[model samples]
Target chain A: MTNVLVLFGAVIFPFVVGYILISRVPQLLHTPLMSGANAISGITIIGAMLIAGREGGNFGYLLGMIAVVFATINVVGGFLVTDRMLQMFKKKGNKNPQE
Target chain B: MEISLSAIGFAHLLAAGLFVLGLRFLSSPTTARRGNMLAAIAMLIAIVATFLDRQIVDFTSILLAIAIGTIIGAFSARLVKMTSMPQMVAIFNGFGGGASALVALAEFQRLSVQAQLPLPVTVTTLLSVLIGAVTFSGSMVAFGKLQGLMHGAPITSRLQKWLNIFLLLVVLVLMFLIIGSAPSHALFVILTVVALIFGVALVIPVGGADMPVVISLLNSFSGLAACATGFVVGNNILMFAGALVGAAGLILTQIMCKAMNRSLARIFIPRQAIQAEKALHDASGGVSESSAAKSDNKPQIDPLAAAVQTLSAAKSVIFVPGYGMALAQAQFKVVELANLLEKKGATVNFAVHPIAGRMPGHMHVLLAEAEVDYDKLREMDSINPEFKNTDAVIVVGACDVINPSATEVENTPISGMPILAARDAKSIIVCNYDDKPGYSGVENPIYQDAKTICLWGDAKDTISQLITSFSG
Candidate 1:
């Protein structure tokens, strides 16, 4: 029972902090913010690593391997795309390499 | 072993702290790029710490899978056009959800191979599977709609709401069975299948124009699914990061819903009230006819020529862009025109509607990609009152955002939705595909205003013509 309460507390703590922090994000960077947050959600890869890297390489290994791939794609793709967009947003006369 | 566990816990704590700090910096433009880097570093720390776990023995397969994913992910991210970023995000969200679901499934499989699982594990695993599958399939449908692979209009069946209810009931029953008795593998598989179908059902009825809200909600679901998986696997880092993502997505969703003046429920299950409202407004058509008649009293002059004349005389200009600008790929030309106007000694600004384009901040991103100075872009609320003082407004492939009917009419599809006050400007130049109603299916009356010039054609061609005529 105590473990469950701690788990719930863990979830709630970040949720409230994220809410307060993200609400302050301006409308200008919403797309990048969303994609960046999406990338961080790929933290599930840690759990996937545990499953796939376990001693017994069986059915669970296959599922875990696939999970790792999916999570990696989300993390790598999400962050890069977000960066690509953030790089585009510039003030007047500021240097943008893509230009 | 005890010492190593404690060290790993400490590393995870540090990573979580960095993640929070990273998200905090992401809120501002000046530090956003650095924020992304921080988050990436935090991810690295978490992964390395996880590597120190004693249970991890097979690094070869894990490394290979990550390599494959990294190559595919990096290539897609690099090659995707700026305009297609929404679709790219949707697909990435799908993969994240799919991964979380798979993790939960693997853990459940490993546990079920032994005796009956604990009640907590059983519940969390089921929750993860259900929510993750829904996010995964729902995001794919969103991707298809955004990518033009599927129709953008709302696709519904006669029993759409009822079917969703039935699916929910079935899922509940399945979950109850798993919880009530022993955790059966076959039952779990059935539950996963049902959840996946429910996901498709949930998102398909939402129109493409409402995709911003749907995408944000699905993004939230993906995070919550990860959180559930964290609970199932007893991982603190996953839970913390997932919850943060959940919160971020919800905040975005709330903002989008408010910007569009739409209720979350109405976005998912649209009513026939809008059609009835449209019928009522169409019956009372005096407002539109009067405006049209008033416009007819002006001396006969070509709209494009009049627009050019207005542009030449105006000392202040505002540009309003929408999804049509994206479809026509006219951001560069629009920017070119804005620059030309500025060079002609006109004060220029961009009036960006909150719900403009396909996603939140979509128009700003497109304009930024075209090298428009971010300082020139103004949010709707701040720019609404300035429209009255503006000498001329250039609306590029936009309609609903500038539609006067949204405010004038009651209970229509877009009634009460905040709009860019383009009608308040002295001279309006609309470069739209046609004078047709926008995605809202409500006719825009501002096109018939006496001071408005409707240049009906592709925005790219029309904007180029404006630039050429102005330059010559």
Candidate 2:
């Protein structure tokens, strides 16, 4: 019963909240926003970590290792790319002194 | 190394809160970077907590994988140009989905081999594999279309719709077989392969012009896949984060579709139906106004000389760029031109259409990379009224957005779509490679307006030539 309740909460609650939040975003920032959201979707990194950390033998280790690599790429690549894109939106007059 | 389950759960709850806060920050440009960082940090916490689990048996392989993934991710993120950002996002989305599918498969194999698979785990595992396979393959197709590795036109046949439905049903049946009785690994493998094929089929019919919507939709699919994987693994934080991404992506997809005055269903309509619809609309005189205007003889000006003369005399000018500017790799030159025009005493501004380039905000990012001031970039609503009083409008390689048919014609594909009011300017100068119609396949009557001067050549070359003439 708890699992079912969590499942419903996870699916429905976030969707409503996320829709309201995302609707407020300006069209100008849509691409960066999508990329940012993509970065967070790399939440699968948690599952991959579990698989890799589990004592389920060699095949599990192989699959877990591959999953970790791919999820890490999604996490690192998605966030960094979004940051790079957002940096371009800085006003021309106010140059950031720090790289 | 043995952390209490409640402690891990508490950490996950904290991480989920951070994810929500990150998404909230992403709603605005000023706070977007920090939002991304917050999410990244949350992911780091989740991964670290997972690593500390007592079940971990090996460290070397895990470290090796992390190293390889970081190097590849960081390098690609650093090196990929802003113009190819969409394709890179597609690739990353594909990787996420593929990872989820692999994780699910590994868990299923482990459970089934030990004959300890629970019903909920089996159902979620099958779902994870199905959605993951589709997202992985569908994103690859989207990436291919965006990168020119595959044709951008819709590939379709009369049987395409039925075939996709049939394929989906077959995969479902195979999934049921795997879950119903003594779980057959062979049935699961075949289902995964079939689901992958169905994914490819699903994306192939979507035309190139609709790729932004497809990319957004695929991003949502990847999130859903992750959510299913979370269920299989019983990870609440993963489930929550996946739900967040799924919802956010779907909302973005809807926004993109709305911007284009299209629906998700319309995008899936077979290519033949779309072509026929266009033909039917055209035959009913929906395009007659533009076609009639096209028959008029508008003078073809030497764009370089005309641009030089008009720009020199203009008090205010609006430069509207489209996908053509991106394709020409001429954003830097465009910025340079805007600067020169400013130097010549013209008040120069850029009119950005919401859906001007291949993706939302595509043009803004391109211009921003060229160091164009954010304040100078005007959205469609803000700039439309300025066109009438503007001295000149310089359209560099943009077509459909500036096409008067969008407003003047009826029953056409882009009839009711909002466009830049470049036609209201005193003089309009267009620099395009040719007189080719834009993505909508509608003849742009804006080219034939008496006040308009069409310059046929490469946008970069023409713009450069104009710069030289102006300077000389």
Candidate 3:
């Protein structure tokens, strides 16, 4: 159907663009880039939120709650860890700490 | 007030655009933090939009779960040591994968109550369950290997290949049965169980050294699982972001495979099988001559004293750090030594190999944490050509990256893997734990070379000694 075709197009578009952009990330930032990408994959939290907040049985809501918790941890932990790493990279300066 | 589906769709489209820009900003370190912030903001937008969906009737439980997750996630991120970063990433990946699986299961439960499930929804639900379960369990195995909770060596069995194949066949058959008839809870549960086992089987035979490739592959699997869930839930943003991450993980896996000079399949197929064939070849060849030479070449000079003399007289030096350096916790001492050498009128640079630490860019982060100037950290290709012109090369707890046998030997696990040109340096000082084969288990011939000085011991003690001797 047209709906399937449109969804496929959406998926392909982001994937191609992401591949082109991510391939250029230098070796120096590979770890941060990976952690950052992992965080982005936590977009599953959106699906979790819908399931959790839906008008469903107690068990369904509980399942959704657990999913939300897990996805949020991945999203939050991944980004913050990546930031902590990015903060460490400093260019050479005259006031060399080691010197 | 009810929100329109088109309004939510518009918000998702905007978030997707921001996600692309966020990744684009990661091309350089200067813009990377802003990129991360951008992506974080995108996530916020998506979450807020989801909360406004008309189907969402309850708010208290979801908000409470977010708070719990936030506290735990923030504390772990803020408290984890940089050295344990690979494990941290692996565990977080597991959480993401598990969430996707849970979402699919919840949706299945909600849909199963209906009279009939659409074929497309049923298919997507099955795919999500399979991929998500595998990602979750595979990542846990990776985390355990990296964190030393389990043996870091490849755990293989004679029947592993057969078992994995059988499991795949069973899963396929189950899919057919479920699609052929009305889906049942038991069939889905069985499929999830099989997929989880398959994940463990897929990663267990991989050695710790191959964890970077495995972790990246699992990241890709987690993304694909999310994409499948998106199809099940009919969510556009989930599909878009998931595909983006999936592509990113695959690209990283490809890069790692190239850097390590390994075929994609080699990471999973146990190296023991390859080594067995190599052993047969070596037994019939002139292998004993090399062993004899190695034994006769054992330490002839006081390498530590020689190392100190070379440090004092050298005008140019290159420092190579490997996983061993990280293991020895010698980054700070290494910086101290580099400073001493510099003060003594010697130029110093740190050569980082692409596969240097447990994961990609691991060594760079550790060196940066030790306050080493980013400019001084040269990547393998960029620094390799300079090794020959350098006067002294100080290898701190590194072995495989600079091993000559990788290029010199044939039919070995690391044969043809590009190595640092440390052998080309005029004088080499190695402060390592031992002259044993590294993670690849291939004997390094460079240690026995006449121009190389091996100061074998704990890297921290050895480096501290160098600092003291050079400063004095």
Q: Is the docking of candidate 2 incorrect, acceptable, medium or high quality?
A: medium
* Prediction 1 TM-score vs. true: 0.96
Encode model 3's per-residue lDDT on B1-472: one tens digit a residue.
4347877988898999999999888768789989998999999999998887888888988999999999989999999998899999999999999999999998998888776789999999999999999999999999999999989988888787788789889999989987876768899899899989989999988887788888888888888889888998888899999999999999998989999999877788765656744643563243423534655766555677889888888999999999988888899899989988888789999998888888888889998888887889898889999999999999987787898777876777877889999999998998889876678776666777778887888889999998888766
Candidate 1 lDDT, tens digit per residue, B120-193? 88999999999999999999999999999999888866688889889999999999999987868899899889
User: What docking class should model 1 receive?
Assistant: high
Once fitted onto the true fold, the runs of candidate 3 whose alpha carbons sit more than 4 angstroms away are: A1-5, A94-98, B1-4, B273-300
User: Which pairs in model 2 have colliding backbones?
Assistant: A53-B56
DockQ of 3: 0.81
How does chain B of model 2 score on TM-score?
0.91
lDDT of model 1 at residue B456? Answer: 87
Q: Is model 3 an incorrect, acceptable, medium or high docking prediction?
A: high
Top-TM-score structure, candidate number = 1
Query: Which of candidates 1 and 2 reaches a greater DockQ?
Result: 1
